[model samples]
Target chain A: MLTLKQDHSTLIVLSVLADGPSYGYAISKAIAAKSDGHFKLTASGMYPLLTKLEKQGLVTTSWEEVKAEGADPDATGRRRKWYTLSPKGHKQLAKHIEANRQMQALLDAFVAPAVNDQNAHA
Target chain B: MKHTHGNTPKPKPPTSRDGIETWLDVLTSMLSLPSSQRTQVRDELEDHLRSRVDDLLVLGKSEAEAIRTAISELGETAQLARHISSASRTPKSFRRFAMNATFFVLAGSVLTASVSMMIPTHTNTTLPGATEAIVVETAEVTEPIRHRFNHEREPVVDVLQSIATAYGLSFRFSDGVRKSPFGKTILDTQLNTFKGEYTLKEAIDAFQARMYMTYGETVLAMTENELILMTLEEHKRMQIEIQAYQIPSWAESDDDQRNYGFSIEQLISTKHDLEYTTIQPVNGSLVVAAPPEVHAEIISMAAQLEAIGKSMQAQKTQQRIEQHAQMTRRIDRLRAEYEAAKSVYFAEREKANEFSNRIDELRSRRLFVRSNDELSKEQQEALQTQINNLGEQSKQQEITTDEAKARFERLQSILIDAESELILSDINDALPIEGMNDSKDEMRTVSIMGTANMRSGIYQLPEAGKLTLARFLMAADVQDPNGKVLLQRGGVSEPIGTVGDISSGTIDSIVLLPDDQVVITAAD
Candidate 1:
């Protein structure tokens, strides 16, 4: 129901990857499930960020072939790119988490006073 | 399955596959990434799309509906392509500007010092007393000076001396600059001698340009009312700096980029004899450690090489077009010659046949007259004489016919040779001839036929010098001790010698020219 900006998307993706190595689709699925289908990172946004992360050495990628169930053994099935959070990526995730906490605290400071004022008027 | 990137051909997109493949093909083709990366990206995306489609299908959706739903989820193809391109491509402007900035910084730092050293402290006044360090101020250094040669061909020393006399200034020359390799001093080098008026700097720069063009390297600088001349190499030794030069992209592939690097190195370092300089090719750019002037020279040389390469490529295409046209013309001429020879042969054969028929009629008349017994003895004798004369004419006609047939056969052989030459010429254009002499005369080839220790093929010759039979045999590694060798030149074949005799210096006078063939046969 909400479109995620790049910084938030990167934080979410890196946080999802912090748990374990996951491909684009699995990462997308995890984002949807964690947000309860509220946060959305489209394919266009996901891939370029992943590419930038890989370029920055924050993530490492390897490919594996995925075959359909009951497919012939000799066939070269579909390929999936697996991305893993590097040591740098873990450090980045910690920084983002701390920044998010500070931002949440700062916003509560402003919103809590506004809510109290509205309740008093009521 | 273990995925490998090797020589294996890339897998083709699956057949439509409910339009998934068609959509992927369109997206992949629009990608601006290099081939290997493009293929990897496509494979990765295909897996994601297929996984999404399968998930949709599992949710009780029809196949078509699932495919359509999955396709819509990928967002617009063009936007995705642009994002990937922007993310993947290295910032070219930043790279180019960085390289330029490095070179200019090095050059600017060096030239700043060199320029200050060249500034004059005082002004020039007296001609003869100028040798006592005539002081020319920096402002007066740009003042126009008159220099005129007394004669048409004046020595460089006299010309400079005349300029010194007219301006009341002194000139100094380094020992290397004064000494010419061909003569005692560069001062002895002749110049046409310009009569035009120019500022001191302009005059010296103009003279330096001329000297650099004619000779190899010369540098001139002015300091304190004195003109200083020295070799560019010596000037470069004063300051050494490392600068990165961006080789213009002549080709898109890595191999061609490396070749451009090599070509620039060969032109700048090797060809120009920049001995103490080090040139390294780094990521499609040349990093050179040399003097500031030498760096300037290298950049100039690289530009010239690129221009030359483009020019040579254009010339080669033109040569190929001309070669094809020439071959066609030669073949047409041969065909015409063959047709003319055939006509001559037929005419000779007809003349011979007529002579034979006339001789037969004469014999028939003689026989009839003898049978009549009523004819005079003189009449019978006349008939016999006519038959004998006609027999002689028929014999001559037969000889002429044989000559025409031989001529026709010779022309036929020539026509066949010409056609074969055309074929070989075409083959030469298609593929470079292997095992050829490393020669600048790439256009010339010699054919070796009729058996040899080596393969019978057209071989290229050296740019210059005779390709004698003995030398060719040795070069070809022909070791047939008892094989007779014949040299075929211009459709005429003559025995050069036995391979053993030729190799042993017994028969070494036979020289093979371009288009010449060497025929080998087992010794009788």
Candidate 2:
């Protein structure tokens, strides 16, 4: 799970983040849940990346008070600062998506007919 | 595939001034991170950590354990930092290149280009305040152009200080930090003396004696145990003085004016001592006998001693449990054996007694009937046999009683010895440190130039007190060549002699104390 290629990791993160802006915890959980118990991030690994993105101004932040139902009114609100990708982040995402699409097309053009011919022979 | 890689989530910036130094050391050592990158890395790491910790707490982990587990995942700080750097252009990622301690990364086209771009051209460099502009090239380290600037010109910023006039020139020396130059000199001398091969007391005394000679005619200086009065008045708080238990009087006493470490028991003794009560300018040479409790208080000082005594208390409690178990078994076994032997011996003796009584009754009846001469020979022989049986059983019971008594005495001796061993160990540990931890407060000393003379009169008599201890000493214990006695009496110690003292004779590192003296122990 850990030794996945860096490009594969980038794809996974983009897919998870596309749903909504989430803080470090929710985002990490989104990745794990979407992968169905395939991957997780250590705090050390995830936090630095979040900070780097914020530093790059590719993500913006907002604090939200998310209260659970039947919770004590006096208890501290589930206030968390959420992080979402900015316009620049979206543009960068689009470029990567295009590159991935081109790679996929190349693979389909070169290897699809060959794989089909082999299957037919069998 | 758009991933923000270099983002390290640090906890919100720690707002404590206290943790700066400690955290600096921790972070530097942990990451082996360069000084320049420290702040950014630390801030970012801290912010991310806080959020993650908050996340963990939400995820059902304890705040403490979550923080611990979160820190654990950092996975050898250096590697994680490198990975984070690859994700972004954070300075922590660029640390290796900045310090010029990088591997030959010829493959890094981007890094190579950036390095080339960073080196400034020589045309921009010039010497300050020189008519002939000296354009020095930093690119080539082949030549040197030393600037004629006064390197020692006082720093441009005096804005951080409130300057004051002292002696004549404007000075920033803290007058509040030192009451008198005499104290400053004494402490300075003491510190200097302790900086090398010197004992603590020797340093104190040598500096003190120098002070005595210098300021001999000034205010009366207190000497040794007579240095200050230890009293309950000093103990404003019930803080335990565990470091060999020497409570500074300045901290304890309401009279914080006097600055010196006050011995807690020494203070207690001052309050209890009649000498302190009678300490007025007396008319005669009064030999006042201090109360007997003075000795007991001194002895009781063993309680104030911390680490060693606490360990003894814990160890003795353990021993008591063990002794109780063993003693219970021994007593039970002895009692069982003795009871069995005793019952058999006594029962046989009882039968002999019954036979003897019958014989005596028969003889009495013969006498009453006036037929004393017609006694049967078989009856007389049977009475004799019963008398012999009675003697044997009595002897057997005596043996049983002696055997039981002997076993009881053996158990008693063992218990006594065990208890004694515990007491001795604790006692050896309780020897008061002569002067390693002196007072942190000020003493009003009359000064002669730079030396602090503590004696009221010139070279006043040092109040001698005996310090007897039971360490297995074969000399070589003290740092000085004082033949183990150090200094017997009024001799002035070596000038500025303060660092060395009675070192461990090391009758083995340590051992347990007896249960009885667990309340007061010296076993370190």
Candidate 3:
């Protein structure tokens, strides 16, 4: 609410966990993919968010090893941890998704509509 | 208490053979975080992670593997340690912590009270309107007695009641009301006397200050009027004694007089015409006019005092500004300092000017100036030159404020000496009550509005042909056909004697001889 935390960290954490369960490393990787190398939420920033999110009861956590579909790559991919969502976390994520969708819709409908018109006219 | 938040780093749980105790210890630590954060962080993390570990075991993972995976997913606890430790370093953080702790304590107390009230707990309950009975000791001393008391009442009231009890007093209890002593608490007990207990001297001093502060013109008018009236009365008595030929002739005495009473000159003279019956003078300090030197000195000393008062006020104002300057981090203080310095400089200059004016006034009134101004025609030009030179010297050196101040002090010293001489002269010049009393005894002041004649029992004379109510007397002219000249018998009562009834005759044509008495009367 205070914007005291970084938006990238919050977005990465929310989106990665939006699907199902994930651990800290998986969230970091997911953030990298989503930003397409444009942004990276560091471990330093990511760990603090996990702590705060857990404090706010937005996410619940557990531990499980990552298992590859085909041949298991050495221990790096074999036993990585995971974090997951609670019911409260699911609700928060839904709200976050809805807010993001509305913001995009408004941006498309109201803001820069003139730019689209100009392009069409040209 | 431990704050085992999610990012909180923990040393590896001791490999206790008793697993439950270790796990329970971790749970307890987890619960120690702030309540709002604890439920979310501790309970959710513990429950979710514990179930997840159980699930992993159910899915065939070992306990250590499950625990490790769960902890790793929660993130490193070192971050919590680092953040909390760094936050504790600041003073403001500690202040916030204290404020939060106070809020939590009050909230906890309120929650406990509400729970107890709803459950009707008997613990620590105070019954409504339950009066506490306490032992109250009563004692007495002399005029001011010391007392001691033990009660559930307020400590201030405790002391006050102790005092009141020492005097055998207490709160006056009434129906739904209580009353206590009006002057129960004294911020400082040293000050005891009031204006109601003022002495004559104190009253005089207070009256003097009050008169000076608020009623200056009134006091001045009253003072001048009293002095002028006394002088006028003194002159009046001299005139009466002179006209009656009952007073001693004026004789020049070279020595100064002390309290002009019935002097040796007045005691020897007598006349049958009139004599003083009796008199008395009030107790007063007759402040006679001082010699010119003494008067000049007083004027200068008064000026010096005024200057000193002004300079002290200016200095205090300057010093206060300086003190304030020490407190300033704000820019306005610089402005204040400049303003204060300017005011101090001007105030000092004004004091210097005031002293100069007094000196000039006194100098001009002195014998030296008198001689200079009243010099002969041949030397008048030379005197004027000297006056001009003195004036120039006086006006020069305007910046010698300290010199003026020192000279002001010198004038005060001269004033002190001259004042002593003036006070000493009071012993001779002032009319002491004894002397004034003697003069009053011999001076008869009779005020007659009309004629006085006793020869034929005819004194009041009524005027004719008009409703005149007043009367006057003059010597009658028997043959002049008009009563205008003085004769042997001065006047008569017109309504009864020596004049015809004007109502029945042409009275305006009446004439009288030289020795005839005349009476004039008027009535409305």
For model 3, residues B1-524, the per-residue Cα lDDT tens digits are 12122331212222212222223222322221344443333333443345444444444344555555555433333333233222222332222222111111110111111111111111121111223311111111112122232333233223323322333334221211112221222212222222232322232233234323321111110110011101212222222211001111122232212222233123222321123221111122112122222222322333454457557656755664464344233324444544555565566678666656766655565556456666565565565666566666556535555555555555555544543343223222221111111111122211112222211222222111111111112112122122222222335433332223332234332322223343333222
**Candidate with better TM-score, 2 vs 3:** 2
Write down the lDDT that model 1 would get.
0.62
Greater DockQ among 1 and 3 belongs to 1
Give lDDT: candidate 3, residue B357: 78
lDDT of 2 at A121: 100
User: How big an interface RMSD has model 2?
Assistant: 20.9
* TM-score of chain A, cand. 3: 0.69
Q: What's the candidate order when arranged by decreasing DockQ? A: 1, 2, 3
Per-model TM-score (chain A alone):
0.94, 0.71, 0.69
Q: List model 3's recovered fraction of native interface contacts, to 2 decimals.
A: 0.00
> What's the residue-level lDDT of A20 in candidate 2?
61
Clashes of each: 6, 55, 22
Across residues B1-524, which tens digit of lDDT does each residue of candidate 2 receive?
23343343333322222112222233332232344544545555554455555556455444444554555544444445444444444443232122222211111111111111211111211111223321111111112111121112222112101111100113232232235444354333321121222222232233334334442212211111111111122211111111111232223443331222234334655567433222111121111122223323432453345346556656755775475456446655665655665566556556655655765775566465446555577766665676566656656655665665565556556644554443333333323222221111232111111112111111111111112222211111222212222121223322211112222333222211111010111112
Residues B1-524 of candidate 1 have per-residue lDDT tens digits of 24332222223233223346645654664465666877888887888877776666445444545555676777666556556655654553212111111111111122322211111112212211122321111110112333543434788777766654455557777666667473254656787755666544445545554455455555554432445555655555644556556555455567776776666667665455666677776665566676544555664465476569767766775786688678779878988988998999999999999988888888877778778887899988887888888888889989989999998999899877776665545444432211222223247777776654554777775443345567566445466778888888889988877888988888756655668888888777
* Stretches > 4 Å off in candidate 2: A1-11, A40-57, A60-82, A110-122, B1-25, B28-65, B82-97, B100-524
Tell me which of candidates 1 and 2 scores higher on lDDT: 1
Off by over 4 Å in 3: A1-8, A63-81, A117-122, B1-524
Best by lDDT: 1
